[model samples]
Target: MIRRFRLAAVLIATTAVALPGCDRPPEEDTAARPPAPTQNADQPLELTTDSGAPLESRRGEWRDALRALLAAPDADTLATADRRWRDLYDAFNRHYLSLAAQACAGDRQAPLQRLDAWPLYPAYVDALPAWPDSGIVNDPALELSAASLRRQQGATADGEVALGFQPIRLLIAGAKGAPRQAKDLRAEGDEPAAALRERRRTYLKLAADQLQADLNALDRDDGLSLTSLRCALETLDDRLAALQTHRQATAPEEGLYIPSVSVEILEETQPKAALTQLSADANRDARAALESGYPGFQTALDQAVEEDSWAPLGEWLHAHGD
Candidate 1:
């Protein structure tokens, strides 16, 4: 029973392995071995007891199993060592959902404790790598991989956090590189058609990561602390503004001009594409608000250009004046 319970505990900890796009190293990979099959063939994804008992057979058996294993003295210290980690994992999901609520255009504010609690969140999130026996029945990684596979009907989900921006990337790259024929522009510049789409995809992914960092900081709720949120908004505004300006500058030269397309792309692309629906909405709103701030920023930038008052803007951007 102790050995079996230990197995069960391993299974529970393995659930975190299900997070998509997070590839564990070979030695640390969860699912390093075959997992024991659960009782129900129809519900392969269902949690199971260490003894291969179906977790759903009893009232809240899954949680009960977790509680019991956590309380056990002799079960295995390895299980106990991850106690706080698991608790924090559960907390992160809840908090992540809650923070999603705060994502809106103008007044995004997650509760203060959530933000304050964020720095501690990564330790718990990152610790999933350390859990033992990932390929076991209790392995979360196997379930996640299975789930992701199931989700796309055997197609791998790229862990995309926003609309695939390969199109935009391709378009931009073609424009940046030596001028191509109109036919080539449409053919090769189209994200889906471009051979270099992967590179653009990479850039979009990096941008998404940057946006996520901003979201994480905003959600880091140290008592509804607006400092980071404000900074995030400001950063987003600057990026959007720069993007807008770049689009403006390049539009005439590209011969493929569409301000609306640029606007749409800027509006739709965001950091939290793979999160829960609520969190995604929150992020959308936050992004919108950030975008809304752009008008003022654009005006400021425009005035700087119009008056040739580069000194103030330059000084503001640089720590020192020439």
Candidate 2:
């Protein structure tokens, strides 16, 4: 049976504002962002399981899956590879990525973590209902290069995403409600359409390559300690609390990508099983770290674990009947 951590009583709160020209909005205030977590630099940790398989191993697996997907010869092959890549991506996000982010907080690698999890808007990468001619796919003025893509990674207003996984998803899966076929991406028998098709394929490869590079950077280090774990939990708690606040003020479609991704990860598993497993893993690691010498982390860890800081997210998902 799937289990959940008991929902926390006090949720993290944040203010949300609507962005012009888009239905969804991004978080506005950064003043309440948590302070950089403290880590014991002298004692570097190697996060792994009993079998000694490092957390970054999953990143390598994901990179392999991505390469397979890009090299797919036909629609059928692409579809199969796509599903496999997505499953690995979801698993990595739910388990390893966040932990790595916490472990590397305030380190030089912190920027890489943010780039990997950057907010993505579907419209920025491909066409959407509101903006049919939107995204880099349709815009001929924008060059299809890594440098060009990097420059377009952020949003000028709210609810707009120019880069990241969502863009990659849009490029691979086609536009929302309108999936692309192998023929659609093939450059043949046309002027504008042919050029567009070629551009589409180019964008997909570049994005995937960029994503793999970031993942490789992150995989280089797997050192985490009790302090890092505590930081991870607190960050999660803050995110859940912010999600709770945002849910009250807007519709599900209008919420932030972080919450949406969090819900999607939970949904990928059986109801609450993913979160239950996540908490279990955190607690297990926390115990191991505590035994090694971090004494003061117990109070915070107990509060975070006991409250099941992610309960509010589950509640929000259920409320929307998602």
Candidate 3:
């Protein structure tokens, strides 16, 4: 099952570790989770490991590392934001896609197994303008998942829920809603639901711990390749484009995932303002690198212009290359 708490912690894992009476073995012990990728003194930090479970299994590990970098007291990443860009891209991609895949797995109800009585979900439903009839709401397997949002507890008219990453994302992002029920972790049945839920929490914490340790061991390599820098520039351009498109097309009250996901949900922060600010920050960070040397700069500039990417940036960089 996959569960996220206020967007800060999302845990998705399978099984309880050995119970004297249970057939299922204990959850995989993470004590030996892979060590951090070895340092490449030539670059900031290794973005990924050569060997691991697919991106799905290693995301939390990466997020922890990335989060630590962001929190580092040394502000040196400012000079080499390309590395941060690289890390953010991998972390964002892995996080967005993997959570959906892992949580929606196995009966599609797996993610919701533990949310049976969580409090915030009901409030989340009552407030929706109108449920999206995206077919996801009607899945039989999600009956229990939707029941958690039953507004009136037993009301048949409660809002329907689709298989969504947004609600969970909102949860993780420190949105207003939070789990209210007492979580039980005792190993109950041979295949106890309780055990898996507990294991998810344990697993998530371990993954976070692992990531932090990796971050502490990593160092910034100022000599990233030209190609890597160009890639980072393009990534920021892509994100800005997509986000602008979404913001323009989405309605204000729709809870549509970003910017306007509601100040109510955000509590203290403004994601809308922050998105624009981040794009600007990333652009500034990449500017020096993007404009670094001459002929290579022209080639990178040409690619940006040819692709019709954030044209203003391309034109500006092309006009000012050293």
lDDT of candidate 1? 0.28
State model 2's lDDT.
0.48
Best by lDDT: 2
lDDT of 3 by residue, 182-301 (tens): 232232446545544344233223323433342222222333433344333333333343444344322313222332332222222222222232234344433343344323444544
- For model 1, residues 1-322, the per-residue Cα lDDT tens digits are 1110122343223322111111221223333322222322122111111212221232133234334432442334324323322332333333332333233212442222212110011111111122322111122332223233223221221111112121222222222333222232222455434633233233323332332343455343333212223333233333333344444433322222223333343334321211122124334443333224322323433444555443323223222211
How well does candidate 3 score on lDDT at residue 51? Answer: 19
Better of 2 and 3 by lDDT: 2
Q: lDDT rank, highest first?
A: 2, 3, 1
The candidate maximizing TM-score is: 2
* Estimated TM-score for each candidate: 0.21, 0.64, 0.29
| Candidate 3, superposed: residue stretches over 4 Å from native | 1-193, 196-200, 206-219, 247-311, 314-322
**lDDT, candidate 2, 193-253, per-residue tens:** 8887788878887877776665556555455655554444434444344444443331222
Instruction: Output the worst ten-in-a-row residue range by lDDT, candidate 1.
Output: 118-127
Give the higher-lDDT candidate: 1 or 3.
Answer: 3
TM-score order of candidates, top first: 2, 3, 1
